[model samples]
Target: MIKQTIAATAIATASAAVSAAPLTLEVFNPGEAAIFPVASVLVKGQQDAVLIDAQFSRGEAQKLVQQIKASGKRLTTVYVSHGDPDFYFGLDVIKAAFPDAKIIATPGTIAAMEKKAAAKVAYWGPILKQHAPQSIVMPQALQGDTIKLEGESLKIEGLTGATPDRTFVWIPAIKAVAGGVVLFNGLHVWTADTQTVESRKQWLSTLDRIAALKPATVVPGHFAPGVAMTPDSIAYTADYLRKFETAISQSADSAALIAAMKTAYPAAGLESALAISAKVAKGEMKW
Candidate 1:
């Protein structure tokens, strides 16, 4: 039994000028259960904007499209943070709303997206029903690590977490990092695709690298609705991963691991990730 809160909370705020195209990030948190809270951000310039990571499900995507349109900013591009279904599945709605908006991703991300298309459709379609994307919308291969958006350079970098080739957008001007699956603020960290201890360690290293950049703000892949992504959010995530690693070593079995984890972090919302990770650890599940 998966319980959820699919509520959308909108946040409109401005940041200091990074360049002539000072960005105002408007985040929409669709508090959906089973599916974690997805942060769909509209990075608005003075006259245009770039969307980062489409939300999951058709209804969620449609709502996001409406919000972007309502902002009156000409959407120029949509950059998905990773290959995960939650990140890119709503591209259909985005394309429908902003036909001229170019969708872009890293070369590795593009390849991963192509590989996972079938599995995603099969797994998500039944659950999401009409809300799931009717077909895959692939992003164009990013020519270089950086893209110029309204005179500001948005740097695209790969950081592995939920999946390899996970992309993060760094705006040097504003010192803001648009973290994909690599960061989770006030949300359950997804571990279904992380299959090994080495991989988890690498993910931690990736997080550390992002932290070193010392962004004034970080927009995580999943976050509490309307709440700002702060440095504390990064700390919270780092602590959770450490605890999860320790719990894996101390627990006797999957059930014990989950029970202990629940007891240790009763307030954490996404229990599904715990269950899936535990099963994967015990060789009882496959990602």
Candidate 2:
């Protein structure tokens, strides 16, 4: 396990180092859905540090907080992979842990959160009641594809499939990527955001590009952390997506396609897989 690695364990030794950052991963509960391992990276510099995704729920976020409680370092930044409630709602629960932690989210995500505040009260307010979310802030709107925080550099790329407005972060240094959509594990990739045929084309092609990167580690919005993005993993994701396009081109009815694909998918949680596949494939949702 990486926990046993000298670099991974030496976090404590860098406690007093002149220049170093403290990084760690935290797991979050994905409600009734599969438990996704959400990573909360802590970058410690001097007497402060930053945290990534809190968790999916208040309870799970607390667990993350408890783990970092001993760090005794100040939490400085909080970057949300996207605007999904599943990723940032827990911020309310761990606000105290990072009293000054500024919530960093894309401008689109910030807008989404604002637009949904009224309709999705339960998802947003609960975080305040639960994690208290010290403050919700927008990312500086990092101009280029790459962004630098503290000293860590990140590449921001986006896709419009799972979520209408979502982007993933690529950390070159760690050879790791954090995608907002749950592309791995068992969750059927949500095609809810796809609204047009052309858009769907862009989405699929974009995912292919990310996979081609073949990251050493992948952290999607959901799913426990993946050690290495194997060719099988990337291929399966692409294949899963292509199946939808194929079913669409074939003009297969959603109902029948869903049933047939279900039998073929066999795997748990794939019922929606076929349905979503057909819907987006046919451009029913436009994208």
Candidate 3:
């Protein structure tokens, strides 16, 4: 009788632990209204939450603050997955709201942000105007590759990849992926930053790595409204990159390349991204 009681107790304890740490994901995307259709994911456990990426504008970050407050979970960490302005520019707002939440990012990401944050702010500050962040809030370098939430692990992948700064978070317990700048859906893929052919190839390789995980849920860092967060977005991004490469080779100038992409993706939003990417690819514009 004693042995049976001990076994039952252990089993019950294990089950309760599992139940307590079933991480749930809530995504916030400001659709097309904001400059970029960037996404911020709030990963929630029973009592704590970890936010992935702060949005681009102050207004959007304020919205995220409201969402987190509504979730009733204590915001423990804010992990900026990428160093881009769209990913971390709004950190000031988030940090102001949750002063105690740890703001962190990979060492590589921190390095990139440190290098470019000033220039990015200078460029977009006027355009964003009231929506711009009051000031940039840089994230501390995360020591390791995993963040713990309610005893569950949120693994940060791609540190060893070609671009260590551009990483994604993989939640193994829930079999979901919070794909950062490495993935896009329902919009023109941003190729301006990855101008070189080799860089684009490495990005495609990263997408393949995400697919290999076979995640049940995939949240893109940027996506159009109404687009489902699924593995299909991975396939869409890979295909768009290939088409973009082909257009780059065939077109004689940026205009031609832009025209080709528009013909291919007539309904796609974010023509600005396509235009700039084509210009950079064709050597007409220096990014």
Which has the greatest TM-score? 3
- Among residues 3 or more apart in sequence or in different chains, the pairs in candidate 3 whose N, CA or C atoms overlap within 3 Å are none
lDDT of 2 at 39: 41
Q: What number of clashing residue pairs does each candidate have, in the order they appear?
A: 2, 11, 0
lDDT of 3 by residue, 126-170 (tens): 988998888888888888789999899999999888899999999
- Candidate 2 residue lDDT tens string, 1-287: 00011112212211111122333333333333212334444444446555656665466677667766766766766676656555665676667566666666666777776776444445445534644344443344434455555576666677334443567666665556666553544434455555456766776676676777777655544332223333344555556566655655555566765655555455524244445546655556442
The TM-scores, one per candidate, come to 0.88, 0.68, 0.91
lDDT of each: 0.74, 0.52, 0.82
Residue 120 displacement (Å), model 1: 1.4
| Highest lDDT model number | 3
Q: Which ranges in model 3 have alpha carbons more than 4 Å from their true place? A: 1-21
User: Which segments of candidate 2 are over 4 A away from where they belong?
Assistant: 1-49, 70-73, 122-150, 159-164, 224-232, 249-252, 270-287
Q: Model 3, 182: alpha-carbon shift in Å?
A: 1.0
Comparison by lDDT, 1 against 2, better one: 1
| Tens digits of per-residue lDDT for model 1, 187-243 | 556776776888888778777878888988787776555446666667767887888
Decreasing TM-score order of the candidates: 3, 1, 2
